[model samples]
Target: MRTVRNVHARVIEAPADRVGALLDRIASDDDPLFPAPVWPPMRFDRPLGVGAEGGHGPVRYRVTACTPGRSVRFDFAPPADGHHRLDVEPLGPGRCRLTHTLQERQGPGQALLWSLFVRPVHDTVVEELLDNAEHAATGRTAAPPTTRPPLVRLLHRLGQERPVAVPVPDGARLARTAFDRTDFSDAWRVPLDPGMPRDPRAWRDVLPFPVMASEGDELLLGQDARHLDFRASLLVGERDVTLSTVVRTHNRLGRLYFGAVRHVHPFMTRLVLRRTRRRLALAAPAAGSRHRRREAALG
Candidate 1:
């Protein structure tokens, strides 16, 4: 197996010292690299550190070494073979650059997996991590749309998952549930307008687009359009909330639809997360009436 390596880098708008401290305090809160306690379940058996083991979905890795703020490395666990290194370098007084590199040996049939899925997913995930870091340091994150080549676009056309979580607004449970049923759902639920259908031939309008499935904290909704099954689920967690979509193609038409927009999918996912967070922040009134009263009185 020939050793294959890939490197991804991003700049953060924060002091090198701050970024280093932020990376070292890896308690799994808002680390976009780790799965949020939402859908598309991903977990680390324990906290990240030397010898700790964890994986998200089918991906797994074992920490091999660490240097707190400067760098860390993880050796791929069995069934997978690789070394992933994350490091930070100083840029200036209030800025720093970060990099994530993956060097691996394709084992067994791993080469196909790497080319087809792992590599693409890893690319997106690394970018997401950079965004997360910037968000942590400066409260904003963005990059130009990531363009996918034909093969990658074709691969994503059949399906893709965008998982993200945001802090749920206070007393906004009903707002969240209702939003799922309105134009937000319409975005992925086909017609773009699920308003009352006016004509008879509008057969697709008759049934209530499913509020699909719900259990305890999670609520799911979707519409089965002709060419594909467009589905989304919203999970209400004690501390945060999340949504993810499943795009299942029915035939050629679905593939065509997906291929055209697969590149946009990840970008849209980030946009959705940003919007959700902004909305939540706005809707969440400041707590502590005593503090508010003092400011009001002073005014």
Candidate 2:
């Protein structure tokens, strides 16, 4: 058995039909608003349509009922025993109120589990879904969606989890905003430094800590486990640089899992850490040899 959860929202300056169409089109392109919660292009069975089995994750649903411009209902698709409903009603000219409700079946003892375990996870998904809907209805984009790191947590089943990767501003080309200036492109490149210890064979052995990567003038950092976004450009002394990264954690089956962006910087960091450790090990013997040589000469 699953406890029922409901979330309601209002969409201003948009009619029910217009809003409905946007939701229908969500599977077509890579919506910037709902980057992580993506669904593959769908094939509809009817006019308030239902699509075939598709999408990347365990989350799936099929539209059970739809009244164009009025409401839509989606039932459990698979891997989830949940159903969601969306209702749109006119508020005034060029405006409408939208309501969304989510309900799921729970087995015996599920209430305790939901209250103690699943509430937070459900809250996040509901919140994120509403955020995507709101942002899509409005044409504007947040300069920085969030400055906070992605929420990371441990799960009973999955070690540590985070949100999937999402795009952020490219620091190199971004014009200076009043808020941020620490662009990634201009950030210090730790691995490239001559004095830095590096390992050619294994990256983790070289760079133990995380480092940033650049594209054009943009600095990008992302961790898929926590669903966190960090995009800030701080004016350091003179040059404008950007720091943008997302750490996300996804909670499933009462367990948390951890995964960072698999990219060049992380790769380089691992390599550098490995080689540096190796070099230190080899240098230790030489230091002893030198000490013995000096002592022998003195004798």
Candidate 3:
């Protein structure tokens, strides 16, 4: 069996009730998570509540059962013999999580193919679907509000879409100023070097967010809603050093939000380069080494 997980976030200006109504509409493909048509167009009888059903399309299968705000199960045959279950659950105050599992039955070859090839495609599809749902639920593209609305509670429900986008910053160039004005002081120079103990210059990307390099040990990474105070330091180990990073979401929006918080270890930054260089150094003959005798004997 192969499993995939996806998350989406958006900042919806609307009230919780407004968002909930929209989410209820999105539960089935007839309403759709996104405005556009998706491939295979999940066509099933508009389930009254939830239970078992038979369906057909690119794959023929029996949808064994389903729960409105919980999960859906399908048993596939013909084009593919497998069983799939789509599960949804709440994450936090206003966030939800979706998981899909696919298992091949009766054929080892099909199972191997599923593990190797078919799995990734399913993962990508689920991710895209979730993102589209996030965009739609958040009222993301709505024009900036001239006046902020009174605080409203958020809803977290399975099979329901929620907003994930942060509000646009005040000025058009706000993001740029934050980048330029960052004070690179003792605070910025975390003792950590990027992922490995290689060149400190090489590991900035692996840090937290995208960063700007000022000089040798100096670097800067952008901030996000989850962790506006994101910071990192380096820890040296016997063989490999680790990047110790910290971030706090501090949900200032007065509501819960969902999003991935990417992190980078200082040492991980140079891991690839260090590993490659180490391999090359080892492969080359050492000067007057004990191994030389073995090499000479082999020759």
lDDT of 3 by residue, 166-252 (tens): 222222122223333332211112111111234433444444455532323333354554424444433222323233333445554
Clashes, model 1: 1
- When summed lDDT is taken over every stretch of 10 residues in candidate 1, the lowest stretch is 189-198
Against the correct fold, how does model 1 do in TM-score?
0.50
Model 3 poorest ten-residue lDDT run: 152-161
Which candidate, 1 or 3, has the higher lDDT?
1
At residue 157, give the lDDT of candidate 1: 37
TM-score of 3: 0.34
What is the alpha-carbon RMSD of candidate 2 to the true structure?
A: 22.8
Best by TM-score: 1
lDDT of each: 0.55, 0.41, 0.39
Candidate 1 regions exceeding 4 Å error are 25-29, 32-42, 145-299
lDDT by residue for model 2 (1-299), tens: 55767675655466666666555543343222222312112233433365533432344567777676577677877556877776777777667766778788767676676776556555544444445555556543233232211331223113112212223334333323322332122222211211112222222222233334433334323222243223322111111112222332334421222232333644443344334433443233221123234446789
Per-residue accuracy of model 1 over 1-299 as CA lDDT, tens digit each: 87789998888878877667656654353243331221122335677688888755456777789887888787888856778888889888877888889898886578877887768866865664565566666655566534555665555433333334434433333334533333222122111111112221222122235676555555556677787666555544443345445566767888898778766775675555444433333233221122233346789
Look at candidate 3 and tell me the lDDT of residue 246: 38
RMSD of each: 13.9, 22.8, 25.6
1 or 3, greater by TM-score: 1
